[model samples]
Target: MQKINKINQYLLENYPSIWNTRLVWMLLLGIAIHIIFFFIGFVSHGSPSTLQHTRAIDDYFSTGLVFVHIIISVLLIVGWLIFMFKNNAFKNFYPGSRNKLFLEFLQYFIIVFVSTTFYFSYMTGFRLFINYKYDDETMAKNVDIINRSVPFLSQNIEDYTLENRLSPKPFVDFYCETDINKIDKTKKYFVYHDRVYQYFRLYPKTVKQTDERGQFIYPEEEKKNKTALAYFENNNDDKSRTYYFKQQVEDLSQYIKTAAPSYYNYSAVFYDNANNPSTDIRKYRYENDINNLNNKEIYKQKQIVINRETIRILEKKSSKELEKLMEDFLAVSRDFDIANNLNARDWSAMVYHPDTFEVRSFIKLYQTKPNEIYDPNKAPEGRYGDYTKTVVVDSAAVSSDNYLNENGEIMQDTISARDFNPNLDREVSPKDYFKNNISGFYYYTSDLETFLGNVDTIKTDDFFWDAVHLYIWIAFALSVFIFSFRVTDLRSLLFSVISAGVIILAVTLFCVAVAFTFGFKGTFFILYTILVVGLLILLMPFITAGRFPKVVSSVFMIISMMAFPLFIWLIFGIVNEHQVAGCRSQVYVSDTYLNCRGVLDDFGLKISYAMIMFTFVFLYLYTGFIRKWKALPE
Candidate 1:
């Protein structure tokens, strides 16, 4: 007891500046924690040098995994933070000394004001500054090589754009609204891209499997495995998931008796798809799949025979005529890639339903989808998938963005004005267009025959908003926390700006660190939510005491608060959008929503919740709602 009393007396006697000492200690603490977190993230996620090699899309794929790492790190940060904040060690990382007055101001600034503002900025906003930037024809030729410099990293197309998706009427008529009976029995309709071949029906119908029983009691296609049959029998699980895929092989000889009609392989398996359709399905598909190679070789030969005959007919036509037809087909094809390099002699086309088992004949030596297929970087279901079939042309390096719309109920074509001069609807740009004759018009009819081969329309989603967007939403909470707390004193303003900045910076470093390690895009938004809420939740306890007045010190925080999101917009511009190289700019990319959205959907609508929050926060501070704490230092 004597020793304890002596120690207390000695500390008071020797160190009259306990608060100054603590401020130094807290600053150090923040720096150390930041360092440790950075190291851990670096170790687990791999260094930035390593990440540079990993493609941007690869990072996207592992979003869930990355976030888990963030969660674990957050727990660690929180544990250390408890030690620091509870013992008042958090002041070590800041400039303020241990002086009681300084420590008081530092706490308000470091913990509350800064963190909320910045992290929200990170999520919703982005910008870039770029121009054609000194690339001539030769450099343009080398652009592909430059972007592909990363080993194993390849650019991909984000297919969510309107160009890639089927027209709503056709997408629903052909792919979406379905009757199994109608699809299989009545084909002979256009299926989008350039299949222009004969089919008895649009889709074939067969009873999808349930248990070992085929919809058709045919013993030939019965479920082979006992366990498979049992699982298939569970209608709740199997039927909900299973559906039949059936189509009739056309006996084309009836139309052209001279051509031999062969019943060949009913189906073929493809890797990426049927344009370059692989006979090899050993990698991902079940070994026992009907499309499996071991069992399908005999069927392959027959299909080959049919394919060969079709190729021969295509050859009989002058290659020039065929090339023109193909170029035209490519130009009007929505979501197709018409490249410079294609087998001018031959190109193949294909289409399939993803959710259905109803894939068609795997055509080879055909067309390839462009590298820039239409998918936006938004959310799943954000856009359509790759629509072009990869076709190889002799000495062809295809780069044009022309494609026959994915095989659909109708085909969209561009007819030269000289071909058919329709009356002009409006002003025409004759720059690339030939001597004009046709009036601009687009139309569609229920009867397939009445459809005009050409049509046009346009719009942009400049202000499209979505609720699922992460940045837009968390800004809402941050805005509210900033605005809602009533602070009349100047320190209220001081605490807010200071703490908001520090806290936001710390949280962002922490969040990005964790996201880097674990691959969590979702966590980006969640961290934004947590920091904004945490600032509000944790600070609620400190508001009553002057010693803890970092909670609400300054008043009239409106001006700065209202400008927060705009400030973020400015930052993205300065940083040039921080995106991976070898990609097009996304600064003005339109917003979109997934079927299930929480907060970001509003951004798609162009509604700024962050702005709203800032306004309210500014209002709260201006109204003198924040009470003064006596001990809060100036």
Candidate 2:
């Protein structure tokens, strides 16, 4: 108790204003209150959930708690203001110069403002906690899932297996055909042959064919045909002739029939024995058969028979290969399904939704029937009348039966039936239906865009800190305005406030009129003009030599409390605009051209600094002048 008294006595002797205002006690209490609010906010925070009712309850609790905290802060500040006003050290003739008085004012202002807005810091901390505890883990899990699934899903299976003898294209074609018609289309030899031919055509590989001398027939020599050369040179000149010639050449090659591995030897043998019919009877038979294969329909039937035989041989050889490819596809599909299910669950939890009851009430309010008893359980229906109408385009003429005069001549109707509406006669618009029926959760889904928005907001960046700092300055400005009454007499305060209000109203009206007459630039010019005029008024006391000017300047000083920082900001804006214009004019290749937001991005810090510097400088001079003016005789 003795030590406490000694400490209190020491504080009283050294810092009378601090002791009288009970500033320390109030600040400690404020800190305690903020800590309590932080815990409350942390405790009340809800995790993402699937149940709509649970989310709704959490939202209400969190929102209501914030509101209550804000109200309590307001009350606490009000009480602190009352307590501080009870003892006026400045009015009591306490030992203080201009600097001391300004410092005292600053101390009071900082304490009050900080106490009021410290909640912002606590909230930011809570967001940081959430980001660390939950969001990071979820993001890592999502990234892992994406990494595991995307590579396989993005691959083209056909490209991967193009070199394999038993390609997966046949199986895919078979699957698609079965899916569409509930039958294995591959069973048909023509279908299977067509698929195989298409697969080889799409993924063309070099095949070496030998001449009778056993020398390989190079593709370069085959492509040197004069007719093919002529077609290549002038293909665009005749589209139909080019297409016909291309198909004729392809048919002559019998590419599908000869390209099959099983029939390659047979084709070579047939080619070799084309002119040796007398040497071998079987060769003579084949030669006769080829010479007789002149009819197009007979050739097609022979091709079909060849395809049937080729398919039977290939199927027997590659059934196991086909099964392996199918298994691979199914494995990839299963992984994709797993990833998709995880994404859906995460998305459902991350999306924002309003309270279900609130949404229901809003719908009920807007969709109620005009003359019927309100029934919550009944579904709302739109009123209807003759609402459906169709417009006829490029009509020849109106029928005489529809529009005719009494003498039977056709007459135009001045008032069209389409223009007449005697009742509520429109179907409900799509927008209204969507608004009344759409769930908030479905409407605001957790897509990439919404996820990015949430991340941007919650991330602890310069933007978040800047916003918090800006609020603190705003609170400080309010404190200064409130404390201005403590520094001046009641009559002066009242006169200054009323005169400032009138001047503000007049200036606002004039600026609005200028904006209407010209545009935003004109309003901007008017505001700058007012800023210059106010600056001149602020400088008048220092430059001029009279009590009247000083007194008038002092009155204007109270009104200009908030304007000091605004003046600096406006000047900064002008300089930034000039810089942006200069950059735009230049042809420099740089990021400045792409992003020309400003000269400096830390606007909040700059403004806060301006507020502090201008407040100290202005208040220091003003306090001295007011003190001297009060001493002078009227």
Candidate 3:
């Protein structure tokens, strides 16, 4: 404590101007105020678990604390700037020789450097502590919640899936049947599956056959074949008959391949018997076997192939088959594609019975008009299960109020993938829908809002407030430059400001050129160039002593000093732009919501860059000052 007092006494007595500078007072006071706020929060919040105080104070009380911090910071800066003007500390220092000039510059540089160093160190230290506290508190809370819930949720687990309409308990059952019998035969069967949905709409499953006059239908055998024959005869004049022929060809090929492999073998054997009997006998030991190839399968395959080939031949012979067919089809029915284009919206939900250890599942499917996923008039035509009991999985869950209008149709503003569809009768597992959503029974929570609402809200005001704190120091530095004119005269002040502007402009243009030429590589080079140029400017005064040279030297000094605060801010802006862009592009994950988690890391990196630049500038000034002082004649 005595050593600290001696050092303080030394600075106060020997470097009175430096000791009295606003820069020093502001930093010292700002840091003291921050420490007070930290202590207040630690006490009021009870230890640290309840202290959600981030770098940007979360609680109302913390915000008030920050307000006080800002007020003190402003007062310190304003009060010190006033003191500099009143005391004429700016004119107190002057050098008789090169050595003395260097010594004077060194003294001023140390004051500014130490002030800046202390200011940043305190700000960053306070922020780091707050951030760590928040992280630790969040972890503790989550761990406690998990610890309490784990044992209760671990028992009687059954894999509930929407695909099979399976329930965790045997007593719970689904009403919907996915089986694909004909709509008429099943009384009530939904064509929810893609294969069945497309098939029934596109092609007639039970095509009716007619006699010569086309007056009466016949209950005939080979129903599809007979129907195809009748359709061909009736539409022989119309070129659209080719569609039927083409469809027949496809059906025949598939049927022959899938239904009658034995017939294919029989045909191969017949050809070999007639053309290469010796080779055939060598290849097949089943030549005399009774079950070698069945007659019934051979006959069935032959008839199908013959019928299809005949239709295919007729189709090829028809002129402009596709064009005429399309025209005729359109002419007959303009809405031919309407049914095929039905909008299919699927929704899945899981219902957990915490009391009975049963999880009821529901998959609501809506086959609606084209582009109509939600219909207000109809409330998903009475499904077999309890629709009210259904609940969305974590990923699929969203408030209906966000999407649905007063009339129950999708609102204009809230039409997105997350919007709930009222025409919806589907429930797909959140896991199945997102594939990336959380899995396991342990992840389920009865209150989704409660689970998710605890997330920290991103208050952009916090960042701006933090930035304001930084800019206050920048304002102080700039004020020093402007106020330095009181001692140096208006001419020097004008020259410094103009020269600084020109230098910055030149540097900016050069950076642009380099960036264009070499891309990021060039920008990196420019950054190094800035470092070199900054050092050169700091040392330039030691090399010359003319009035113009003095003016130029003073200009560069002020510009370099002023640029320090802005340079750090510029680096921050660039990093911030990059981080925001990155976070915007990225999909949200559990640990992050809109880049909130990276705030501390981002700020830390900026501070680090600032520290590096400041250190380089300091070293160059200090080295030049000492060298000149040592070289002076005693």
Candidate 4:
């Protein structure tokens, strides 16, 4: 208790202004208030899991909370200022030099400003915490779901073969004319040539021999054969109809050789013998003259051959079943392509590849025919289950003839290959295929978008530092304005403030007028001249011993204290401009020249250091001069 009393006595003697002003208590109160505000900011909004709740929270924090904070700060500052005026301890009892007085004012100003504005630090910390937590959770969930849902292609022979088979390749010609008539006229079907030939070989006797009047003797068989024939003849005119048939025929023939080698061998021999008339006649003569064999045995052998071919064609249809199996394997390929191209950094999280099968399929199945997927007015189901609640496609997604460049410049081009034929030129990897397209497909809930939008790239530490630096400058300016009341009478302080405002306004208008009339160089010249004249006036107290000169010098000292940093900045700008002009005139300009040789690198830090150094120097000079001016007789 004795030690505490001694320390209090020491503070009373050494720093009476700090002791009597109740600065410590005022600062403690400010800290307590800030702590309360921080808790309010951190916990006011409940954990929101839906878009509606998130939006409401965002509105309250961004607008309503900020407004309330500002009002409270204003009230606190006003009450504190009134309390400081009532005490007036520094003005009454302190016998400190002007420099010491100014330092004291700085201390009070910083405490008040921090007490009022420290909530920003807490709020910033809270935002950063929420953003980090949400981003980590969302990224983890998205990556897991995407990996599970998408099938990645690997470098393997089996996969390569599958890719080729599914991909659109050049057509091969083969005989498919036999089954051409089997195709339905009402529906569209891809034609293969080998299937046509198989139909003719299977039902060779189905062709009708019409009478002179073209009357139907065998109407049913004739009609069927005629339909097949007509389809074959009509489609044969298409030059590109030469695909898939050759592979089909070879596969079928190989199957036949393996499955029924005896039938294949016998059919080959029988066709060869029947084609030669001498062999046919010799067989008939031998049957009639010696064996007396009925034709039933020969007819039965021929039926066996026909039955084998019929079973093979009907069951396998030349690997048509295999194609269906491949389609099933690649069912998620389109959806994977769309999801794989998503860019989380982008606000829309969409990266479109118009040439991709996924994009083409979407354009065809959704955009072109909205009814096929869902009503246009209603939200469509997300491609990847519940990860998204809405899907939006921009109009640019449908445009085929124009695309944006790196600089966002639009260039014209021919219609993309995907638009011409989506099946053609299929890429092995969806990433490789999506590089050229600019269209977008957005699929995310509004809540998710809000979370993503709030995920700023700025580090929390950097934000806090910036806020501190900005508020310190504000505190310094406020301190200087308030300190003016201590140094002079109310009338003199008011006159000085009004005069300063008027001079600043006039100078700004004149610089603007000069810049508009002449150029930036004219404005620069005017500012440089004003800085020189101010410096000259500041030196007047040392040059001449007169009340008028000392008063003028004192006023200029105050102006110079503030304007010195700006003067340094202007000089740096002039030097950089001169260097840039020189670099531009050179014929072989390097990257250094392009970047202006980094003349203004770390400019802010340099300027800040300069300001700090000059501030003390100006205070010493101003206070010393003021002492002498006060000593002189009025």
What range of 10 consecutive residues in model 2 has the weakest lDDT sum?
Answer: 264-273
lDDT of each: 0.30, 0.41, 0.36, 0.41
By TM-score, the better pick of 2 and 4 is 4
Best prediction by TM-score: 4
- What lDDT would candidate 2 get against the real structure? 0.41
Instruction: Give the runs in model 4 whose Cα sits over 4 Å from its true position.
Output: 1-14, 49-61, 87-89, 92-94, 97-99, 124-446, 452-461, 505-524, 537-546, 549-554, 585-594, 597-617, 620-622, 626-634
Instruction: Kindly give the stretch of ten consecutive residues in candidate 1 with the minimal lDDT sum.
Output: 449-458
Better of 2 and 4 by lDDT: 2
What TM-score do all the candidates reach, one by one? 0.25, 0.48, 0.36, 0.50
Location of the lowest summed lDDT over 10 successive residues in candidate 4 = 162-171
Ranked by lDDT, top first: 2, 4, 3, 1
Model 4, C-alpha of 241: deviation from truth (Å)? 44
lDDT of each residue in 375-476, candidate 1, tens digit only: 212212321222232211111111112222212123333322222223322323221111121111111101100011000000111212332334334434
* Deviation in Å, model 3, residue 456 alpha carbon: 11
- List, residue by residue over 1-634, the lDDT tens digit for candidate 3: 9975776578678865455454354456656655655455444433322321222234433446546545555565456557666755445444344444434434444444333333333444444544454454663354333322221221111112212211122101212211122112223222211111101112222334434543234224434453322111213222121112112211112222211001111111111111111112212221233223334344334333432332342235433442343233222122111111111111011222222222232222223334544321232443221112222223223212233321235543333322222223464433343222322222112121111222222211243345544544544454455434533556767887788778779888888887777765543466566666666665565554343445555565555555555555555545655565567568444333444433336566457445545644553454454344334333
RMSD of each: 23.6, 23.8, 26.0, 25.5
Q: TM-score-based ranking, best first?
A: 4, 2, 3, 1
Between which residue pairs do clashes occur in model 2?
Answer: none
Report the Cα lDDT for residue 53, model 1: 22
Model 3 worst lDDT run, 10 consecutive residues = 339-348
